[model samples]
Target: MEANRVDHLLLHFFVIVVGLTAILGKLIELPADQLVAWRTLAAAVVMGLVFYRVRFFRQPRKVILSYLGAGGVLGLHWLALYGAIKVSNVTVAVAGLSSAALFTALVEPVITGRRHSKLEVAIGGVVMIGLGLIVGFASEFGLGLVLGVTSALLAAIFPSMNKRFVDQGGNPLVITFHEMVGAFVVCAAVVLGRGEPVHMPTASDWLWLGVLVVLCTVFAFWMHTWLLRRMSAYTAALALSFEPVYAMVLAALFFGEHKMFSPWFYLGVVIIVLANWCYPVARKRQAMRQSAE
Candidate 1:
């Protein structure tokens, strides 16, 4: 098989791995804040071993502080994600998170100061209709959907922030470690402030959390970046957008979550995913039309 083909397969595999985060969040019996605290702490400790030899931490204090602040965003992002799952099922949570692809269209330009693409704005209209269907029909999960969309909005900002660090000659691994440490600090503080002890993971929770830390976060991030190196920017972005679809499919398989939704809810999901998948093709065609003209 061709190398790009192999990369494509690996890319989807990583998407599947990311799909697991929502599932594990549902399985683990902990509050969202503590779960994030534990996840960030474990991830930071593991990344610390990798960081001990490399001095990416040697970047200027200003940049280090910025990544740490950004880590707070990452921590909040996960908190919202898990919160969505705890309040609703994984299907609704991922459906809400699906809006992230559209939110990226809105968020990225504002962050990067690039002019908005008319095509993306048009795509957002379609996504909004899908979201309306979700909101109107699955209204019971309204809070969860709101948090999921909030998570999506935060997800949109994360990469643009990381890109600045990468441009500043900081390695991704080091940047991630700093973010993890930052997130752990924020999450731990929140956990402590709640007047509850930092809850230890149950044996079953530990099992799920282990899979989460090992496969969903670390391995998924490594494989995603590795696949990006081998594929075009467009292919990589497109591959990542399919994550919601994969997550929904996994939810159905694992939890029979499909039975809980009305037809309109599924219709909304289809619309969002289709709009996401269509954006790249639409952009490419518009580029071709402009070039030919």
Candidate 2:
């Protein structure tokens, strides 16, 4: 972590930004799909400029197309996430989104042709237990819960695909640019199909969307891609586990009345987060023991 200190800081910062993205999204008051379209478009332009300036934009055409596919999935992921918030409250949305790690645990091995680590599986189970407490005991049974779970599932697919895409030498900025553009395209189609009025933002709305694009999406995506280059998928996922916890805190600050939960809420979230944190450590020890044997 020390050797890659910059990467670590960036990853944590990315999580913080990602956590607050929901709060910012809520403030915009646009339909989930429309909001995401604008976000994708804004983020794409920001990332495109970065890619163009940095000389890191080069990638093969096939790889670029692969990233476009990944971006399509990403577009869906954002919709599901925002939809979860619209259908339910942030607590349920955050809880459901927390399951991304669980999905990654199951998907990484199958997608990457690697055997599932026992430690990752065990830790993932514990996190699920914590989430179950958040859901079954603390949250109401409702459509929000269902949407949240769906959001998690969508969240899982894109990141896993991203790991694979990058592993195949895909350019991170290019991939992000293509993906954001793809998301924007898909979102535009969706908005058109529904005949929804695309609300032009007021002053405050523009300010919030600016934060969403610059801090949350652009900077966060750059950090995420940078981390992917420096860290193992499990390490990255473990770090990402902190995101929902951060989101919950931000949710409390912004939407306090709506987000207030029982004491069990914090306890349960802590358990889930700690379990995720332990996964990398546990995996390291296991590998060390096998080597010693």
Candidate 3:
């Protein structure tokens, strides 16, 4: 952890920005699909200027399609996440999303052909338990919880696949650029097919969308890609487990969401966050045991 102090700090900052997405999502009036479509479309448009000089067409066709496919997964993930938010509050949506750490423990091994880490899997279970405690047996959040977990599944997958791509010498910025374009296409198609009204954003919506595109999508997307170069996908996903904490806190501040939970909420928050912070220790012990054996 000390060795990668900078990466850890940057990851926290990224989580903060990601948490803000829920706040913005709640603020925006568009349906979930439309919000995702607009965000992806606007992000691609802005990011094009950054990588326009690159010869994307000359790049490998298979690589382009692969990144695009991953981006499609990303599009669906965002929609599910925002859908959860629309159906329920930010706490319910984010708490369910925290399970991505566990899903990554399961998925990353299968996707990357890596051996499963018992410690990581165990930590992932703890994350799920913590999430359950936070959400409790509240039947009201059932649909939202389901969608949030679905979001977690997709969220775990693409980053692992993207890490494989990045390791195979894919340029992170270019990959993100292609993926955003792909997300926009997938989301736009869905929006059009649903016959949802695609009216232009009003002034307030534009302000929120602008913040979302420039900060949350463009800057955050690039930063996420950059972080991948320095860390494993599982580590990244584990760190993201802390997203709910930031989101819960932000929701409290912005939406007065604190009163909605029981006393178990604080305990659950502590447990989930401790799971993330425990990663470095768990990883070191796993390596030591492996080497000794």
Candidate 4:
């Protein structure tokens, strides 16, 4: 039980790290594509150096290919996330990303060939209502919300794909490394094909990007993978529900993001966050009832 509590705390810490991505995204001056490209490359290089002894290519060709594919999805997810932040404030983008659970509820059944859970769908509907409220009232951030939602959808896909690879005995770190490489490749190609002259990042930009690559991407991700083994999935899900909350709080404190939104926007954010937190509790209760029966 004590171990569980420690894991829970660690999980929350990692979620906060995840939340910081939005702040970092907004702080960086690079275009979304370039930001993602450099971030991924830096992370890949770091992970490659740290796990230098691992034989990354020893995995089956099919597994390596799967990681590469998932990596592409992961790359797209970062692009969409930063793109949202570029167009909108951190609060709007983070709020939209919070809808990942709703997307997962809808996508998981189809991917796993399981019957859709009515309760899950109902909860997802509530989240949709919340998102609708945001879109309706915060019309200025409509495009950012759209991009954020796209990012959430891609977030759902890559995790689902990663689970398959992990279940096949693939090393999580190696998979992450390849995925970073994949993201770098895709983003680099997109940036190059745009035919825009690339402006080099200033020294300050490199400092922020380094923090993002090391702390937010590599360290946080590694902690998440480690904690999942020690805590209940319910615990992790509950902790993650607070990511947008953390982001909003940080935004308000640092960037004054709260001043940019109407009261109704906060209401919508509350609703989405409540739905995220409640779904896990609801699932736990349902599981208990099933076991009792």
Candidate 5:
């Protein structure tokens, strides 16, 4: 029981760190593609150093290639997220991420070849309703909302893909490292193809990027993969639903994102948050009744 409590605490902390990605994405004055490229490169370099002794080559070629593909998708996910932030404000970008839970519900079963949970589908519907409300109020940020939703879809895909690889006995850290490499390669190609010069970061940008790569990407992602070994992906998705809450509060505090939305928009956010919070409880009760029967 005590261990469970500690794990939950750590999980929330992980979400908080993940929440800061948007803030860092906004603070770094680079295009989304370039930012993702550099961040992934930094993470790959750090992770490589940390796990230098591990023989990643010993892994089958198939596994290595899978991680690379997933990493490419993950890079696209980050690009969409930062792109949203650049086109809109932090609040809209983060709020749109809340839709990831809905996407996961829709995508996971398809990927895993499992039956879809009716309750999850219903909950996803509720989440979509909430998102529709937010988008309705913030129509000016339409492009941002679309990009953010696209990121959510990719977010669902990569994690579900990772879960499959991990089930096949892939080391979480190694998968993460390779994924970073894949992201770096893909982003670099995209940036170069666009005819964009890679801009060097200022000292302050370096500091922020360091925090983002080390704390947010590396640590948070490692912890997420670790936790997935013990918990259902549904539980993890529920917890991640709070990420928008954390990001929104931080954005308000740091970037004055509070002024960007109306009370109705906040109402929509509250509805989405409440649905996530209640889902686990509802699932637990259903399980209890099934056991009793």
Candidate 6:
């Protein structure tokens, strides 16, 4: 039980890391597309070293393609997510992304070919209410809101793919390694096609980029992989859902007066967090009852 508690705590920390990724993107003054291209490139380098150490790169072609698919999702997710930060402030971008679990609820059933669970839908609806509040308070929605939502939907695709790939005997580390590479390739192609030189980031830009790659991308994903091994998937996903709450708090702390939204914003966040946190618990209970029945 104590081990479970620790795993739970670590997953929550992962949420914070992802949430704060937007802050890093906002602080660095670069085009969102270019930023994602560099981030994917950096993450690929880190994953490559890990790949060599694990010797997981020796896998067959089919397995490698699976990694590329996952990576494609990863690339698109970052592209949209960073684009959200570019078009809007970090507060609105993060708030909009809080709807990820709602997206997941809908996508998971279709992908897994399982009957849609009522509890999951209910929880998703609740989270939507929370998003409504956040958007209500921050009424200056723009292209960023649409991009943020798309980013989140793309993010939902990867986790389920992770589970499927692992279940099919794919190497987790290799999957991550190749996915990062795939993301880098896709982003680079997009950046280059834009007919602009890859914006050469300065020392300070590199510094913040390192923080994002090391702390958020590398460490966060590694911790999440570790937690997945120790805890149930539902528990892991539920804890991960707190990303918006964690992000919003950090935005307020870092941005101070500027990040502060109206009272409606706080209320919306509360509603969303409540929905995200409650969804898994409800799912777990339903599973237990089914077992007994």
Best by lDDT: 3
lDDT of each: 0.76, 0.78, 0.88, 0.79, 0.86, 0.75
- Which candidate do you rate higher for TM-score, 2 or 5? 5
State which candidate, 2 or 6, has the greater lDDT: 2
Name model 3 segments beyond 4 Å from true: 1-3
After superposing candidate 2, which stretches have Cα over 4 Å from the reference? 1-6, 50-59, 138-141, 257-259
**TM-scores, one per candidate:** 0.90, 0.91, 0.95, 0.91, 0.96, 0.90
* Backbone clashes under 3 angstroms, per model: 0, 0, 0, 0, 0, 0
Per-residue C-alpha lDDT of model 1 across residues 80-186, encoded as one tens digit per residue: 88899998888777777766656666766676566787787688778778878888888888999999889877776765565455545566677778888888898
Question: Which residue pairs come into collision in candidate 6?
Answer: none
- lDDT, candidate 3, 54-127, per-residue tens: 66556788999998999999999999999999999898898889999999999998988889988889999999
- Residues 137-208 of candidate 5 have per-residue lDDT tens digits of 999999999998898888888877876776677888988998999999999999999997789988988999
Index of the highest-TM-score prediction: 5
Worst 10 residues of 2 by lDDT: 50-59
Task: Write down the lDDT that model 3 would get.
Answer: 0.88
Q: Give the TM-score of candidate 4.
A: 0.91
Q: Better model by TM-score, 4 or 6?
A: 4
Q: What is the lDDT of residue 286 in candidate 6?
A: 91
Clashes of 6: 0
lDDT of 4 at 220: 77
Q: Estimate, for each residue in 1-293, the C-alpha lDDT of model 4 and write its tens digit.
A: 22355676777889899998889888999999999999999999999898899887787887777777878998999999999999988888877877776676667556535567778678767877887777777788888989988998887666656545554556778788888888888888889999888878889899999999999988876676555445433345435657778999999998988888788877877887788778768978999999999
Model 1 TM: 0.90
In model 2, residue pairs whose N, Cα or C atoms come closer than 3 Å (at least 3 residues apart or on different chains), thus clashing, are none
